[model samples]
Target: MSAFDEFAAVHETHIGVVFLVGERAYKLKKPVNLEFVDFSTPQRRLAACRREVELNRRLSPDVYLGVSEVSDVDGGPADYLVVMRRMPEDRRLSTLVKEGEDVSEVVDRLARMIAAFHSTAARGEEISAEGGRDAIRQRWCDSFDQVRQVGVLDGDLTAEIERLTLDFLAGREPMFRRRIAAGRVLDGHGDLLTDDVFCLDDGPRVLDCLEFDDRLRWLDGLDDIAFLAMDLERLGATESARRLLDRYAEFAADPAPASLRHHYIAYRAFVRAKVACLRATQGDAASRRTAREYADLALRHLRAGRPRLIMVGGLPGTGKSTVAGLVADELGAVLLSTDRLRKELAGRSPRESAAAEYQRGIYAPEHTERTYGELLRRASELLAEGETVVLDASWIRADDRTEAERTAARAHSEVVALRCVAPAEVAAQRMRERHGDVSDADPRIAAAMSRDVDSWPSASDIDTSGTPARSLAQALRVLVD
Candidate 1:
């Protein structure tokens, strides 16, 4: 019998028959044709099998044995297959995530592993500006076309999605080009979905990189990160997704790459939703039902609008910052404080600046301008990505409130201007007892507070003269309800 029949005699699947020969397992790719990928010729299949083995060795050195020719008949080579050290099937991330395993640790481990992998991977020196843009654009177009072919999407929903996609693309293309010009694109494992990750006892391993096409593998690091993040979110691991991103940014040690994070995330979400919708129409009955569920989830998240932006506006010592933190924690939002921004900009602690009388620089017109600008920028960006943002600032100026309102309006998001007010005596007493507070505004500043400050927005207002926890409970009711 031929070697193919011999392998088939051992295994069940005729296409890509997997068998154990000695200590290693051989995976042979059948000469099959797929819509996106093709292995039509024996030589082509052999080359792909060899590429998989070679590329996988970079990450899973112990698992990828090598590639070898497997002749159909004795002494006559007809095809080839990849040989690998068989791993415990349960070690796959998909299986672990399904079992409600400790995915946080697994994802965190993946972040570090991917970081190391990207740092060492080769980057294309000849990546053209237009070439990168076209590649991204083409991916989106092809994905949309696939969805169109499925024919399950309604006309109105498809049109709305198309509009949103075009809007984001138009605005983000310039930024993407700038990032590409700065060499943010590098050789990476293009397909980093959960199924491709293996959680071993030692750590996590990423395999099955895009070895055939360098163009697909060569991309902005954010794209790879987004793929993983999107997978985590889809698997109902939002917290794990957040932790993975946090760990990645911490280990990467550079915030420059973070600017592109939101854009990549949105793109990833869009593509994933599209694919899910397409599969709903094309898959088998059971799979199509599951795909419909995924599509509904995606649509809900897409239409949920940006995360709520809460601006805590009040005079000094009204417990604005404390209450803001509580609300942020409860809402799973980012807490942006003017006090922290001030300290970061001045290179001095709030107390030190207060003692030196040089702290006025933190609230100076120019510095305050910078702080508010950064806060609004971050808030809008996060909100657009469906993340809540809590802005803790005095918001003592009418112009500041107006600017924030305009930002929310432009982003099609909601803003809750929370006004924390307290009696003058109460404010002073709390500020005087505050020892480690980060705000430069002193208790004495409470006495100097005038009544001519900007008017609070007509939105919700909370009186913070009572216990902070109580005040936060009230705010939470308004936010969550």
Candidate 2:
């Protein structure tokens, strides 16, 4: 008997038929109708099924057995199924989260795995600016349509949401356009949720990528990160979201895109809520209730405004990034650093941009003006959208710190200046030992630093020369208070 003939068959409401072979499992796409996806034809479904197998191999090579054609005696294709090495049914991340299991090890491992995957995935052919804008607009339209079909939402509430969606998209159009122009879109796993992740003795195995269309899988990396973060929040694991993000940043060769985390997180939440509402409209009573709960959870996070803006100012190697990252993690805010921004603006890595001429370009009076201006602009936008922004920079100039304060005031938020102070000799020593850092400041730059550097902001000051955890704890308390 063939493997399919001997195995027990199962059915999945959303996808298709599944069969459990002795040591392997097979999933076959079913002919179905839904608003966002369709697998109605054998040829179309088989192609997508094959793509799924290939895409999933990027992250879970051990589990994706391969794709095989079901044949009727003569070895010609009859139907198709994706074969996978079987995993324990209870090993899903969603199950672990629900059971209140210790998942820190698993979560951290998966974060590093995803970071590696993003680094290797092929970049899509550059999209036209107009095309990018139209795609985003269509996403909003689909969201509205999905919400309306549920028929459970109040008319006034629906209209209010629709208005907010439009206004938010309109406000962020420029930044969206910039990302598209910069070629930030790459092939990514489309359906990234806890259910699709399985934990193994070695590490996490991610499976079931959206493979029907390249367009769905190809998107900005920020969008991909946001999906996982939003899902974590919906599952009531806010702290896990922070840890995952921090791990991603630490492992990635390139830093996380500056100040874009808040916007992407909100956008992902909106998408998740809309999809859940759409499913609730067509699902059974039990499933409908579950979907409503997910939608409601996402909405709650979206309405929670950004955390307050806090800047860590000092000379090079003064522990600014370390303290800022810790505070941002504790407060569940995005950490935006000048070091990352300077390199991104120059379109090169820190090492490449560190040439003498480039160094002058980076710190020139005009360049400094532009850099700080962009940082404040991004910080204000994220805060207004309901996210806390942590600005990390060597605010060696009184004028630059003043501009940041002004920006916070205009956003109807206060700025908490975290001044990191250390002995000049100690700062120089630390800078000398640094290597492969994205920050432009080096040991030679520190030698020129004067004790007459700018006056400290009339805010909190922490001496990072001692234990950093203690300093960070104090800063976090101020943020929470």
Candidate 3:
């Protein structure tokens, strides 16, 4: 009764209740202990409130005021509250996004602000461990088990998502170590939803970081930022989400692989799906639909993050390297050339010529097999690590092509085969004019190899007789198709 009636509205969450009054908000931790959070005692709740104020001030200094306590008539402490200066509800980013407002500039500024915050965030061994593969896998397992216990989502969909997530994490130990060494892991905003961001005229104020658990707050900066990105995509602001990530990458100088970004975003989506499922268990019918949507979004991101193995093959002087380069640039793929790999295996520089007859020298059948074997071996490792690979080689032999396909299958990846071809005169002239090139093949070698080449029925033929632009366009079309 003590100023309880003064609150215009009261919002209750699973772990806390917020009282919204004139120009102020008060948060009271609920007396509950869940599997993830524990605020069952007054002392613990007060400690949490103080921690929230101390941490949130790092971002929204002017918003979090302090902690206050209410007293009973008998002069005993009744309850504690986290007092905050209420932000403008109408200026919330989620509201603006739902109203169809253009928030490009807002997102840009937000990304920069987040990057700066992360630049000065706390980092050390403890924080870095949360970004490692084992920690990530454990958190994923926790979410999966929680969602399964709720039994709100279809078991099969949940199982598939879990499989994809675990498989992706299995081979990322090295990448995770690289991230830790590069100082990409830190204590970041754990719950960066659009609903908690206020876009004021001065700047954007982010609120409601998960202060209850240090483990939740300590994570890779990319995973922290992906929380908001995932929410923005959920709100149908796909372009704005992309803009935010691009700006963050530019501002933070983060060179994270695209697959890792997608994976983290997917993980965040699944976490939200778990929460939605919990809400559905509490009898929120609408949340059931939202849970499915989030789960499906997670699945979609998982599929997008899967690695690809693209084989660009053709006889020498068919412009295969050119096409492969273009494709790699377009797809952000790692390009590996048999021409370079072969020379490397033979202890020769790429430009060092090893001219020999067909099936002789470095081009010998035995040597060629070794080169292709090494190529596929390297590609397999890369694919396991969630990288798209473009192999620039003459995959004219059926055995090597089959081996590449098997490698991709082992990695749970996709294989794309492209065969480049040019007119006889064009190819001959290209081989004749070749200089400082890694390939040792001449027009004579090419003609002999052409006669001996096996039929390639599965590869998409890309004619390189036209302009390079035309050839690239054709190859891209084939790739997308």
Candidate 4:
């Protein structure tokens, strides 16, 4: 413990030890097995220390001094270490964000820096296989499984995250295949968060590339930047995060969808959440709170990705509104129901029943069109403010769905339609059980609507005749997938 008086400050991680001396820093690999990496022997530690110095020099060239030895004065080999010139703590990217300094210019520069690195990063068959479609899926499953099996977070939250992630991986097969085929995967800094960066006067020097395992650093370039963006947002620099993405896209001429950005951000957020929970298990009380906070942040990222418009529709009494409400709560979305909006438009309460016959009186053809138009109008407004919206109605007409698509296009958002269906008997039973809810559709009305509600192959289908839990799960899969 009394190694040197020049460096009294020291920090120990699971696999490495760092000592901050005057104007210098020394890092030593722990003689232990981390399951991910092993430094249990002198020769292994020497190799790892050399690798750390070499990998980190790519980003922090000036900071990494060289390798050193922990041998006795008698020329006996004891251990190995990586040496570095210490950087000013105040110049760290995280410190600047904490001080509320304007770092927009540097943040932009950081994006370009990463873009250049990713453009020239090594990519071969072996590297691609490490980040291949199946490997990436397993990586996600393994990460969430770590958190899931440990029972660190809430059970409901764990279940929700698992369902959403599983759906994204299962349904977005083409997205992953295209990226892999395009050679978007590369060896990158596995941990590129803000804290690992220094905003020097020359530029930004990113430090601490994942040195434990080379496979861990093999990644999709977008995923690499995503971890940084997520960290920037976590530090309350949301505008900086947005700027980084915008600048990176311009620099790289990327054509990936807005959905992919959201996907990566959500994935990064969850990864950080898992990290925080792991820290809590190591007996960090503050980290326990941070774990929950990160979990919520991940949910938000998963919810609204570029202001999508989700259309939930079917014949009346098929549980469209019920399922829509469940989705809204899951995504923290703005749900617009025709039954509620129609009453509001008529200067009546949402709970009030308008005893009009099907396709007659206030329920006439023109009224239906106007009601849908207003719903679309409101959805556009919310989307403009960066809000996801759910439209609940019996969209039995082909023109109705087309109109919704047009509205989403004009608002620069994508449309996902979820068509609910149930047997005639189940539909009639649900209608009979309804009392003071918003919708006023009766069993007879449902029969009338079902006659016209032809199948639309474009929309995802959700059979709602099962238990509510099963129906809600199906609805979530449709929305995410």
Instruction: Show how many residue pairs clash in every candidate, following the order shown.
Output: 0, 6, 0, 0
Q: Which residue pairs in model 2 clash with each other? A: 305-386, 306-386, 306-387, 306-388, 307-387, 307-388
Poorest stretch of ten by lDDT in candidate 4: 1-10
**Could you tell me how far off, in angstroms, the CA of residue 377 lies in candidate 2 after the best superposition?**
8.0
Question: In model 2, which regions exceed 4 Å deviation?
Answer: 1-9, 32-40, 73-77, 126-134, 156-164, 181-183, 253-259, 287-292, 305-481
Model 2 agreement with the true structure over 1-481: per-residue lDDT tens digits:
2423444546576668777767688898887756657888888778778778888888887788788888978978788889999766678888888888878888799788887888777775542332264676787677778677777555565565555445445444555666655655678887788888888788888887877666777777666766787677667777887687778777764343333554456567666656656656666455455545554544444334334678887778888888888888877677888777776776777565453433376766677678888898889887654456889988878888888878776654557888887887878888888777777677666555544377774867778887879878877766556
Residue 25 accuracy (lDDT) in model 4: 88
Worst 10 residues of 2 by lDDT: 298-307
Clashing residue pairs, candidate 4?
A: none
Model 1: residues with Cα > 4 Å off, grouped in runs: 1-24, 30-35, 72-76, 100-109, 125-145, 153-184, 198-205, 225-246, 254-273, 296-310, 324-397, 406-416, 423-425, 428-458, 476-481
**Error of model 2, residue 115, in angstroms:** 1.1
Tens-place lDDT per residue, model 1, 115-218, is 77767776665644423656677776776677677766565665565555544454344456665666667777778888778787798777678776767777
Residue-by-residue lDDT tens digits, candidate 4, 268-302 = 88888888888888888798778888887777766
How high is each candidate's TM-score?
0.70, 0.62, 0.88, 0.66
Kindly indicate the candidate among 2 and 3 with the higher TM-score: 3
| Model 3 bad stretches (over 4 Å) | 1-7, 342-356, 360-381, 402-412, 421-440, 454-481
Q: Candidate 3 on 1-481: residue-level lDDT in tens?
A: 2423453778998788998987789999998999778888889889999999999999999999999997999999877999998776778899999999999999999999999999999999999999999999999998999999999999999998998888778766777888999999999999999999999889999999989889899999999999999999999999998899999999999988788889999999999899899889888999999999999999989877867899999999899999999989988999999999999999999999999878888888999999999999999878866789999999989999999999988776778999999988999999889888888889899889888788889999999999989999998898767
Q: Order the numbered candidates by lDDT, best leading.
A: 3, 4, 2, 1
The 0-to-1 C-alpha lDDT of every candidate, in the order given, reads 0.69, 0.70, 0.91, 0.82
Best by lDDT: 3
- What ranking of all candidate models by TM-score puts the best one first? 3, 1, 4, 2
